[model samples]
Target chain A: MIEVRNVSYEYIKNSPVLDDISMTFERGKTYAIFGPSGCGKTTLLSLLGALDAPTSGAVLFDGKDIAQIGDENHRKDNVAFIFQNYNLIEYMTAAENVSLTEKIDPLPYLLQVGLTEDEAKRPVLKLSGGQQQRVAIARALASDAPVILADEPTGNLDEDTAAEITKLLCDVAHENNKCVIIVSHSAAVAEAVDQVVRLSHGKLQEEV
Target chain B: MSIFKRAWTYVSRTRKKTASLCAMMCVMLLLSLVGIMLHGVCMDASQNLKEVLGGYVRLTYSASNDREESVLDEALAAQIAALDGVADYSGISTYYLSAPDVQLVAGSFAGQPQGQVPRFVGCDKSALHENFIYNSFEVIEGRHITSADEHCAVVSDVFANLNGFTVGDRFEACLDSVITQDEAMPEEVYSLEIVGIYTIHEGWEITPMTPERDIAENFIFTDMQTADAVLLAEHGVEKPFYRQGVIFTLNDAERLPEIARSMQNMDGIDWENFELVVNDKAYRDSAASLQMLEKLSLLLVIITFSLSGILLALVLTLWIRERRHEIGILMSLGISKVSIWKQFLLETAIIALVAMVVAMTLSVPCSRMLSEKAFDVAETMAQSQAEEVHDPMADVMEKLNPTADAAVDVVQKDDVHLTFAACITIVLCTAGIITISVTLSAVPMFRMKPKEILSDVN
Candidate 1:
């Protein structure tokens, strides 16, 4: 479980992006964080993924603060990140990019995510938007980390492909018994997850 | 994937960038290698040149009479040779002679009637003079007459051909009537056997005899003791003595004048009739050139090294800039900044390794070829200078001074080796420069956090 307690963040000293935000992500469940633009959705994900520290807060993985355990170690062993850009290395093949996340054979996971063997062999830059997003989802599934923090996982994919990718993350959490937390602006992504939380004015509220 | 594998994959994928970087490193390393090799060789050559050419001085009798000449004898020659800073010494007693004017007084007193006013000349050899050491004479047959060879003689190749005299042929030196009239002409001839034939190197303005063909052809080298014996017979003296110059050379030229002054202060050296002559011009000329070349090599190393470092840093900065996205992605992979920087170093270092091998392999043969070319140029220069040389210097002074001959060996020798120490230094310096340049270029990239690296992107 990842716990964000009394979290507040700011880029500039005078202006806060996240204010006293607190949340908990449990194992064996998928959660969707919905927010409009500039609502600190990416900033929340960044802090959860250990990309950056919140200005004042405690983000704990298994009741221990992630910062105290070392951000690099926490990110490496606990949290795996998926970006909206499908941030796969353009110079590498899809499978090679998957290999960066896990020591296991990357071809299986890439194939599992609907990339054909030939497509997996081609440079990720040659892949289509939906296929690249699938590769990003497949990479998070392939990693040994228990927590998957994705920022706009299906932000660039069509509804059908986005639903398929959201189902993959849900399956990754339900079957694999991992915590999958996603921040997105799409209603389909929010509806597909087991839990939905809306971000407004640097605070999270349960969406009925 | 492992760090090395990732590094290699990137290197293989970026073929154009790697090839261009390798080419630049190859050129930079090659220049450094050549500069290092030249630095070592120049130092060795300078020392050897100085040893062969420096600290040479000639002492000769400038006598006006028989009494003055007698005082500059064999005993004084030995005393001068024993002085401090005198490394080695050789002496020669000259005798006037000519063929076809065959009644030439082989060995007779001064002011005595000359047998046909002899035009040929002979110099007795005690030790190897600078002239012979510097290839003024090239031995053609048999062996040269040393101090130990009493009755042996070495004539010019032209003289040997003219007389059809091969090695082991005997010749007679006939005494004159002025000495014969006083003593009933006992043992009037001295026997000499031809032991060697030699030719002179080109560019020689000096010879043991004047311009007369007969004299030039008849010039001979004999043992100093043999020449002394003949003079003893002419004067009807019981003991042999020297009537020629003793030239002394030291190991270095720093004390050339000091030794000369010391010899003058020595007892019974006949300083009034004899004076010391310094012959350090050749050594000075060679040292000046070496110093100039050393300065040039220093400048070349500085410019090449600095320029190489700057160029390497520039290209590496571009590579780092190009890989910013990769750096960001790798950081997101939870790789430490240090490990990521290592990957970049590994890539550039791979290029450096290949280029180093190519440069080192070429440096060896190129250094030797450069040395051979330098020697060839020197020989060509000597040849042109030879054309400017003439026989006008063939006079009494030339015969007394062996250095008057053209010393082709002093300028023609070109020997160099690519030493192991210098090669090792080149390798180390090349590696150090590359590593430093890579590290310097990576600093800005390494400073960025993963957040910052990926922040500007969507």
Candidate 2:
């Protein structure tokens, strides 16, 4: 489970981006965080990813504050991130990029992500947008992390690819028994998830 | 994956970037090697020149004018020569004589003294030794007149040939005291053996004001004892022993004044009546020119190092900026800032290794040519300036030579060859500079937080 306890963030003093936000995400569930632009959706993700610290309160993973867990251990052994731009290493082949995260065959994961053996062997840049996104998801899944954090994973994908990615993310949460939290501005994305949370103007609340 | 693998992949996969980086490192290292080689050659040459040519001050006292004073003579010069840093010395007494049967091949013989026979001046052993030591005069036949020889002479080649005189030939010469007017002075016609024959390579005329200065070709060199014997016989109980002026040479000409000052503190020498005159033009010129070359080489090294640092930093910084997305992605994947930095530095180090190899190969021949060319340039600069700019070192050389043209030959004979030590030094220095530049360039990136770097991804 991932928990945000009275967390607040601000780039400048006296001007808060995330204000006393609180939430809990359990395993075997997918949660969509929907918000307007500049509503601190990415900032919350950065906190959960241990890339930054919340100005106040704490973010916890499995009842332990991320600050207490140490940054590298949390990111490397606990959480996996999927970026909207499909942040794959440009020079590395799809298998190599997937292999960067964890010690695995990577070919099996690439095939599971619907990638051909030939496409998986080539550089990530040689793949299409949807194909490259699949490589990023494969890399995330290859890590044995129980929690997955994604920022606008389908924002750069077409409708069909986006639906496919959503289904994959659901499977990762439901079938693999992982807590998957996604930050997006889309209402349809929120409706497809197990739980819907809206971050409106620096405050978070669950939709009825 | 491992840091080494990531670094290797980055280096090999980015061909254009790697090539440009390697090019920058090669240029910097080559320039540094050249600087080291040139500086080493110049320093070595300077040291050898200093040893061959000494620097010194001449001390003399006036006997004619009442106001003129300089409490100096052979004894005092000996004391100074024995002082810590003195290298070599010569004390000379010059006397004019009129000898029958000796050839005067120098200038017009004019009249008097049988009106047919030639008369030559007498030069002491000290004078002969000075000229011989500098190669101004070479004893072509037989040996030189040593100080132990009381009645001996080394005739000049021109005079010896004209008079049909060789070694072991004896001749008569007369010396007149100042008091004697027309009266025939005592017979000091010491039948002096022609101990040696010398050819005057160049003449000594350090003091240009005196028209009758000691010229190498005219003087019949003898021992001081013989000259004094002639002087005493001619004086006829008027004077006992005459004193000669003292000249000294030091191991380092630059310290002439310092040694002179140290000598002033010695006992039995009146500092008020003496003034030390140093002619260190030769030493100073060579020393100064070498110093200039050294400083120039150092400046070149400094500028090259600075420019290399800036250029490398710029190229690598741009490289880092271009790879910001990768950095952010890596950070998001939990690679840690330290790992990223290590990989980056490792990448640069591999490129530097390749460049160092290229630079070392090119540096060997390149520095030799540059060092030789640099020597020629400095020598040419010395030659180009006649009077508007006078190099004391060149002037001293010219004065020692028979003709001024020989001095130019002296300048030309200086050669600079590369050495193993120079190459080794260049390699070490190149490696040090590249390593420092890489480390310093990474400092800024290391201080930045991963979140700060990852912000660029947005």
Candidate 3:
């Protein structure tokens, strides 16, 4: 489980991208933060993932401040991130990219993400956008971390592929008892998650 | 996955980048290797020059001085011999002796006397004589005239044969009129026993005016005491004297000029009466060429090594910048910055080691070609400078002592060879350079936060 306590972030003086925002993510459930572009949806997800420290507040994991746990250690042991642009290492094969977080074989995870053995072995650069996104998701799932922070997990995929990826994220939370937080503007992604949180004007509110 | 596995994946899969880096490394390493080998060769040549020149400083009365028969005393010789860089010093005083009872070798002119006056040269140690040191004279039978011999002599083989003389043969000689023309000779003649017989590899020019005593075969070597006793007995001279100055052999030939200058400024010797002649021209000329080569080699080493390090750092930095996106992704996957650094280090190390091996394999022939070219360049530079600053006295000195010419020949023919120690030095230096370049490139990357790196989108 992860929580943000009154987090505020500023890219420049007097210009806050995220301000006084608070949220909680629990295991065995999936949460989606939905907002327009430049609304700090991804910034909030980054704070929760320990990728960036909040300027004014704290991000906690399992009731302990993630800062005390150390940013790198928290990221390594508690949270895994999936970037919007499918930031897979181009030099690695699809399975190798999936295997970046752990030393185990990545073939089973790649297959679970709907990639054939042939596609899994191919370089990640050679894969299609949807397939690269699948590799990114597989990389997140391969880690033993308790939380997944995905920024625009399917933002580049087709409608059907986005729907399939959303279902996979939901299944990961439900079946593996893991916390899944996704930042996206897609309504379908928000509809599939267990809870929908809307962010606007540097603040967050749950869409009951 | 493991860091090595990840690093290997990038290095093996990115074939073009790895090859480009390897080629660059090989070129730079070859240049440094050539520099090292050439430096080694120049050092070896300098050492050989020292052995050949055997720096000898002659301190005696100047021929143009107004004082006739001015004496170079034993005390002065002792003071000079005690100077720094003086390995050993010997006094040379020649007395022309005519053995009227012996059948001496005939001179060149047909009308001259059958047996000419031969030079009786005395020194502390006859073995250290310039003729023997230069290999122009070698004792073939019996022992040399050492300092212990009081009345012993080493004659030339030609002189011994003409007189039918052998070792232990006693001979008597009157002081010839050449040195004592103004003074009367003593009633009793100096008697000496032949102790050694020497053969001449080189001899003097035979001209109508040339004296028999000036020929190499007619020269006789004796100890200082004998010459001193002859002087005391024949001329009634009370003090030990050297008509020909003392020759001081130096330990280091390179320091000849410095030692010569220092001797000129010493307190005891009267510089006005005596002239110090340092035979350093041969060593100076050859050492100049070697010193030029050494400096050039040093500059080559600095430039190539520095440029190589900068080039490698630039190449690796650009590559790391291009891989910023992948770096962000790795960091997002919870891989620590240290792990990522280790991976990059592994990648570059793999390529650098392979490049070093390839360069080493090709180094022998490359060093040979490059060193030869460098030597030619340095020689050309030295020759041009030498032509501009010509020493007319060098020819005179060479004629006086043929050892200088032989030394020049030896140095010019010296070859450069790459030794194991040089190779090891190169390897250790290259490894240090590569590590520094890698660390320089990696430091700034890891200093940044994962968020900033991910935001680059490059």
By TM-score, the best candidate is 1
Task: Please provide, for model 3 over B67-148, each residue's C-alpha lDDT reduced to its tens digit, 9 standing for 90 to 100.
Answer: 4445687788888788889888788877666667766555653244434567789987887677765556789999888768
> Model 1, stretches more than 4 Å misplaced?
A206-208, B62-85, B96-127, B140-143, B161-196, B203-218, B236-242, B253-270, B361-417
The lDDT for every candidate, in the order shown, is: 0.72, 0.72, 0.80
- Candidate 1, position A79, lDDT: 86
For model 2 the local lDDT of residue A66 reads 87
What interface RMSD, in Å and to 1 decimal, does model 3 have? 1.1
Question: In terms of DockQ, which candidate is strongest?
Answer: 3
Off by over 4 Å in 3: A12-15, A155-165, A185-191, B43-54, B62-79, B93-243, B254-274, B360-367, B374-398, B402-408, B412-440
Residue pairs with colliding backbones in model 2 are B282-B393
The collision pairs in model 3 are: none
lDDT tens digits, residue span A1-208, model 3: 6999888999887788888877778999999988889999888888888778899989999889998998889988999788888888998899988888788899998898788999999998899998999999989888888898998999878898789888998998899999999998889987899999989989998987
Over all chains combined, what TM-score does candidate 3 have? Answer: 0.77
Q: Which model is ahead, 1 or 3, in terms of lDDT?
A: 3
Per-candidate TM-score against the hidden true structure: 0.85, 0.69, 0.77
In candidate 3, residue B374 scores what lDDT? 66
